[model samples]
Target: MSVFVTVVLFLVLAVAVNADIEVDCGHTEVKVRWSDPRSQMEPSLLKLGTCSPNSFYDGKAVFNVNLEDCSFRRMVTGGQVIFLNDLTHIYDPAFSQPVVCAFERHSDWSPPLYTPKFNTYGYSNLVFQMGLMNADFTGPALSSAYPLGSLIPIMAAVYQSSHQPLLLHMEECFAAMTPQPQPDSPVYPIITNKGCLVDSKSTNSRFQTRERTSEMHLLLQAFKFPLGEDVYIHCKLMAWDPEGLDSSKKACHFVKGHGWELLDDPARSDLCRCCDSHCMARRKRGLASGQGVMQKTVLGPLTIIDGSTP
Candidate 1:
């Protein structure tokens, strides 16, 4: 009788274990639904205290869960955009156990207006390092899909990379501006006739002093409707490593030259000429004063063909 009772107890325990499921599907779905409060909150709860067909609302929140092999799919319904930052977590079986995951959504997604590609010449290579503020601009600019501001960080990076004294040769520069209406009437100015200078001189006796120079020309113009607004074009010639050089040491120097000039009569073989005689003159003087010759290095010019409206 004692042996019979022991076998019966083992059978009961096995049955109980089979009935217990680790995953609670209903509870998991409920948690996901609750985490997306934006979908459930009444329009009256909005800061405006009302919701309309055009009412826009955005919220950022996180949810943690454990799941396995999770993935997500998104679609637009009723002209509303919904972004599931981490769609995989919901489908992940691992999420069925208790774990933390993140979810974020925004009603407004501002796509880029214009993007430009960075052109390289000869054996030159382009290196880009974007600051936190302009990180969004790098990828789009390289693809030529986003506007001019998006390339600012890229420009900074390229300018910093040129081993020789650089110049902002504006003859090849291009600018694209989005023609959106603005309250401040801000204009995006284009750069024309820009170039950079790089000083390769070493101050210490252990290293040799060398001077290198390159020249380029490009056209820059601000994006403005009237095309005659008082637009300002700001250009900077910074050291490759400003911190590495002493403040008193000049890494590179820049000097502006004459603008576009008419080549006498149009009947002449040359219709027009843009000369940087002043730059050449300054370079000669520098060389005479112990600065080395200006070595020509090729950095591809960026050209802007048109403006955008988005």
Candidate 2:
């Protein structure tokens, strides 16, 4: 399962009051900084589970906690992986705020970003694979070479050898300069907001018809960024109920004048409307027991030749 925890933060660039705070979500940790410009907020007065404020700097009380520590509650829903916690204070008996952090599996080749909570029963046997595909989509692309502006067909599949009924969805995708994107790596958004193909808004990139519920396809247009070097594509793949198609869980693409349209079933394209804005995720009630809903895979080192160069 994949997960994103809601870390509520009250931020102001231009101005703010005494209770103002800022949050920063790292690859394997969550940081909360309470600004005390007036020296009104005391570090000892605040707490996150059993963790106390770790430091005081820049007139702020800082709490930096690991994702797995500080009494974090592990949760999973429909493939999202998440850890949750709450901040309690002696200052206000009724005041409480949630703290959350989440991370996805990058790939077998990449280093582990954070430890995931596995089911007490068993680990997910579900196998996922992604690769560059040939133009006809008949087989894997013989070469990972594409001229700028050319379409790069990417095929992602969940090998359901047991023939289990499963529907695969691309949750999010981004292009990076490195095959294994680090937390600090600069990235270009290709698909965002669950399955919205944001790159399609500017180019011909978009999702294609799926051959099976366990498979997803994307025709990504090559770009000139980083100019003649290789680009890597990373995507979060999800497996969900075949009938549980919701706005936050869909494959949508921009159609120029038609706005966003679903790839598999345009009849339910209304779900694609959320692609224009934020898609409200379902409330996380508990832990993802087994092979929850999501898996992130990598595809790349694909060469992009800028046609303008030669």
Candidate 3:
């Protein structure tokens, strides 16, 4: 009878220790830690929607997520906003009471509204504008809904009064859930390296040639993001001398049958090979550090009804 009682006590302690879940919330981030009493528990068992825990160490599941990321369910009531997320264990049958996190949106912070990136003297007297365009790349888009897998023509332009003769380059771009891209908001990369159409690496996205060099037509596709249904395109736009077309500055797209191709001059396609790995500047320049004619353009809240539910 004493041996039986000892076994029962150990099992009770094991269950109690394994079920402990702690949630820590900050202004912009949340950290979740779950203790594991069983040595056989795997990190894949715990999930935050489609996101896995950031790390698992020392018999503990450690999850770090931004408040605005992972599509935390948001609702408004009484002029206040609330965000909530529930955690689930994929394989744990006894985990009926899943851990949950809910918090009121901070009164001090909200998503910033974006305006047309017009002429800015600070950015080296450059006039910038970005928007969704028509299929022919002639003008702005007219429809509200776009079919899934269809092309999305996102155009960006720079108007310069003086003929400084600067070549435009898009270094990187990501699709977000909101108009104002924040530091912690979740994002999906569409372009990378100096100008690699990384999304085209998987989907049917590429750059269309326009007559004018100032304007660029990025042909993207409509899809449902893991974070949210809404999509925003934010890009880092830079202007450099045409003579200064270095590896750090390029426009490239991956062809289905072929490899990476440079948009401006296909002869120098070698410059974009770094897109497969990483793009590093030969030297640190003031422009790359944020002082040059570089600006971030946010275009979206783009209406994409990609998926429908009955």
Number of the predicted model whose TM-score against the real structure is largest: 3
Candidate 2, pairs of clashing residues:
1-79, 1-293, 2-79, 2-80, 2-81, 3-80, 3-81, 79-293, 79-294
Candidate 2: tens digits of C-alpha lDDT, residues 1-310: 7965443323222211225566666656778877656645565667775467898666667788876555555544443455566676757767567765555532222222333221111115577777788897887787766888999888887765454477888889998876456799788999899889999999999888887888888899997678755576778877776777888778999998988898879988999888777988764221153223677666655678877665
Evaluate model 2: give its TM-score.
Answer: 0.57
Error of 3 at 269 (Å): 0.5
| Model 2 weakest lDDT span, ten residues long | 114-123
Candidate 3 per-residue C-alpha lDDT over 1-310 given as tens digits, one digit per residue, 9 for 90 to 100: 3522111100111111224677665545667777767646676567654347898877778778865554354445554454456566768755633333434444453442322222121244577777777888776777534677788888877777764666777888988876556789887888887778899888998988757777788889876565235576778887766666767888899988889988888898898889889888655345434323667776655656545532
What is the Å distance of residue 246 in model 2 from its true position? 0.3
Whole-model lDDT for model 3 versus the true structure? 0.66
RMSD per model, one decimal: 24.7, 15.8, 17.3
Candidate 1 stretches greater than 4 Å from native: 1-117, 123-189, 192-222, 225-281, 284-310
TM-score of each: 0.21, 0.57, 0.58
lDDT of 1: 0.24
Instruction: Evaluate model 2: give its lDDT.
Output: 0.69
Q: List the lowest-lDDT window of 10 residues for candidate 3.
A: 5-14
